[model samples]
Target: MAGIQDGMTVMVGGFLGTGTPEILIDALVEKGVKHLTVIANDGGLPASVTGTTDRGVAKLLSAGMIDHIIASHVGMNPIIGKGMNDGTLKCTLVPQGSLAEKIRAAGAGLGGVLTPTGVGTIIADGKETLTIEGKEYLLELPLHADYALCRASICDKFGNFSCYKATKNFNHVMAMAADTVILGAEKVVEIGEVDVDTFTTAGVYVNYIVGGEQPWQI
Candidate 1:
């Protein structure tokens, strides 16, 4: 978390509350940085929605740490609307599939992606569009970040990571899209303890590791 500073662009791995690195996120809150541009699927569940504590990115949102967001949706958290209406926050909403492809394009080292998702909608406004074979496509550029926060169900000392079911949502691809990847795991083991085939993401993409994350309350 030391490498992340004010005004940095951060990609947070999650879909709602799932697959989010809560421990690492809390550490960022404790780090007290500001003016961050966060890229994610959703804004996460607010305490009001969870009926418990704030979950996932809601922690940062409530602390007013993020100044801007590039996400698919933010309806889960009411704060997003309030902040935007007051001019304290800036938000850019991308289609879910397009957002995923943009992140994937970055990881794949591609210039951009051609998608027809927003052709007749406002999402295509001010964006470059091209017609090939009578179909229109928008040019969505790769989305990179200064740092990425990812969650894992288990990880070895060398960072071979694993997560089950919905937990793999953004964590896998996000690891490859950032300059540095910080992993927060529910369990950590030594090398060879877990079979190599069980690993979903290779260890090579991870930069730092933190362990003992509890299951998300949400």
Candidate 2:
């Protein structure tokens, strides 16, 4: 079915909006794909904040399906934090900006990038440092995935995707980095429905499209 499987690395798009695909997330849950490694921000939040308890891929985290996560933060999800403390969830937190650049580099087929976000912090603990000009920059490696789970505001039948406002976070670079890209959207339209200027991810990057469920009330 060209679906997700065990031991696969997945990049989930969204900071809080544009990158989440509610439909795809549900499908993954229905399929019960296990032993997964996810890369993104905010695995999911509690139902109080997000109207749908299933919001933000929290379902997977809660079901004990995932094995590892590489993200900027876990958001307001208490369940995932508990899983971490209990040794059920393994996590690696990265700087938000560095995470974005690393994914972009992967999509661009670059080895990695040099950034100054963690020059003297714990983020640099095991990383290499280089002096560029007069400043030191930490080298963060490129990060990609076997599959990418992302949300678009709208997607044409031809697979063109558009993100609205802050929702556009991470989807663009994530689309490029994954071997397979799945999209969930609030609306689906024809190829010409959206202006080319506003299209953040091109049709070429998408492999599947599903209509997203209404967001949880967070």
Candidate 3:
């Protein structure tokens, strides 16, 4: 949190608002950092759905903190659509599978990946293509961020992270795709309390931890 500055690339872990790290997000809002390029699963719930307190990435959008977002889905938030129309924001929509693979490639230190997900469609526009055995594939590059904001249902002092149920979606993959990862854990347990097999994200990837976040709310 100390090193966060305006105009950095940030990856947030969430599906809509369900698995988002509220504490860290709220802090970012209070920090008033702007010109952020965020990468997430989708645009989060709007104020209409979540009432006065915007949920997940929507909070940042509401605060006009995000300048560009690279996500697979943006239809859920009107702010994103309106911004896209008004030229106030930039949105890069990649196919979900291809997006995940790109992040994975960055984390794994790979150059790039070839995928047919966007072949023969508008998604293939202005992109490199390769023909392998008469089938076309787009060469999707890796995605990396300056900081990744992640949430975990449980985290040990050493930073092993585990999520509860569906909340586990993007947090695991996002943990490894950034230069620094900030973890917000609902509960912080003793080092031996959580079994290693239960960890969704290993401790090595986490650089910072904010413990004792309130439990999930509707």
Candidate 4:
């Protein structure tokens, strides 16, 4: 089976609240994969920020494994800056909402999506510009990855997934666009344990399942 490897691009699912997938991140670490390009919302906790065991992508960053980062904000953690300055990390910052839409467009097989988020700013520098009616829009290419790391509230043996409350962030869209998808879950049950009405992510997108991390460990 295709597993983690060096020099691969990975899409990670998480947002401030319900989106973090601690288990999947840990699994990647355990796999000892390196030279990665990670696309995510933010850097996970850092040793300087929380002072406990490292959680989220922080563990990967601390390991000096990642080669590039495509994220909305890396400044939330101090170690990220040091890594960037010291040439251990390379990054490209995209707006949060725009980042989500880009992943969705990629998953849906679209070439790109049009948006006005970064117009008239540094983000518009080298991108194509379009005028629809009287408003201007910037075309952002869709983002897909070699692998997508996601987390869910519960999943069945068949791979269908659902997120709880606010944590549902990018997990849903990233699942669709990646070449391979792996999920971290709080609970796993029979295929029918979760009702069809609440099913947000179907089984076809997921490939593996790992348990979740301790409560708010990251």
Candidate 5:
């Protein structure tokens, strides 16, 4: 894949550190891609007590590569809070389900998603509200990205993918919502090797495939 430019909105598939593409993220860090707007489920885990960092979005955050983040949670990574407090980074918190639906809506070419998830809280502020029948719902805009970095436990030469356990968290939806989708696969195999029943994401949604470091090793 080509290098990522500054100011691009990127969706990184993960739930905390579970499904993040660590190898691809390492590549991004090595390439020094800056001014990125990252979208993920969580901010990622902080550096370990031994001073070695080996988890999710925190690696990008530690390198000062991301300019903004749109995620469901940010409490686990202290770097995120520090960056936000120092005004070096901007953060937007959306309800988890709402965030997922927003991305799905974008992929499906919907105008927006109407949900009551944020009805009477700060989440409703600055957003449109519509009353259907007798209940009110907030209009959450669709969310898309210039690129999506996702993890797959198994990827074919043609880019079809399947993940194990929790690794499937946001990878499937993110692959559909991005203009360019890159898959970091723990094991790359022939197209027919992956069982059709196990295929969670189709090759049509993928643009590139890279060998990935195992999540457990990270």
Candidate 6:
């Protein structure tokens, strides 16, 4: 929380709107954090379609708080298209599977990942390529963030977390790939309340935890 400065790169954990940490994002918007570079799966759904004022990264995008984004898709959010066309925001789109592997490589402390997902396409334009056994693979660099904001279905006092259903999509990986990890949990329980067997993210990776709001509120 203390080190969130201007132009910081942030990784937000979510698939569409399901797993985004809405509470932390709201706080960031309230603080007027600007010129951010966000990394996520998709741009986010619009308020009109979701029947809400803001959801996922759209909150920051709508507030003009973000300057650039590296995501796999943006078609669902008109704001992204408008910004890109108007030159207000910059976007770099990646193959979805490659995106996930890049984040995972960062978290795992690997130099990079090799995949065929982007071979022979524009995605490989400026990237390195390697041939192994007569097959080609594009080298995608790891994607790390200065901070990561994630949502958890449940979090304990010590910050151990478990997500419900599809909410776990990227939260667990993003938690390990950032310098600072913050979580917003729907339910905050005592340290021992969350079973270790069920925990997807350990407290050692988390820096802070905040109470989360319901889906409607987000």
Residues 1-218 of candidate 2 have per-residue lDDT tens digits of 15688889988888753357767777787888788999887676556666756566677787777899888878677777888899988989999999999999999999999999999999999999999999999999999899998888878887788888788888889999999998887888877776777576788989988875465343
As a TM-score, model 5 comes out at 0.95
The stretch of ten residues in a row with the least summed lDDT in candidate 3 is 209-218
Ordered from best to worst lDDT, the candidate numbers read 1, 3, 6, 5, 4, 2
Per-candidate clashes, comma-separated: 0, 9, 0, 1, 0, 0
Model 4 Cα lDDT, one tens digit per residue, 91-139? 8899998899899999999999999899999998899999999899999
lDDT of 1 by residue, 1-218 (tens): 99999999999998888889999999999999999999999998899988998888889999999999999999999999999999999999999999999998999899999999999899999899989999899999999999999999999999999987888888887898999999999999999997888798999999999997899653
The best candidate by lDDT is 1
Q: What lDDT score belongs to each candidate, Candidate 1 first?
A: 0.92, 0.81, 0.89, 0.82, 0.88, 0.89
How far out, in Å, is residue 163 in model 3?
A: 1.4
TM-scores for every candidate against the unseen true structure: 0.97, 0.92, 0.95, 0.93, 0.95, 0.96
How many residue pairs clash in model 4? Answer: 1
- Candidate 1 has a TM-score of 0.97
Instruction: Please write out the lDDT profile of model 6 over residues 71-104, one tens digit for every residue.
Output: 9999999999999999999999999899888999
TM-score of 2: 0.92
Per-residue lDDT for 1-218 in model 3, tens only? 77779999999998888778989999999999999999998888897877666788998998999999999998889999999999999999989899888888888899889999999999989889999999989999999999999999999888998889888768888898999999999988888885778776789999999986676565
Error of 3 at 12 (Å): 0.1
Residue clash pairs of candidate 4: 18-167
Measured on C-alpha atoms, candidate 2 has an lDDT of 0.81
- Candidate 2 vs candidate 5: which has greater TM-score? 5
- Candidate 2: where is the Cα deviation over 4 Å? 212-218
Name the better of 5 and 6 by lDDT: 6
Model 2 pairs in collision: 13-19, 14-19, 18-167, 49-218, 50-218, 51-216, 51-217, 51-218, 52-216
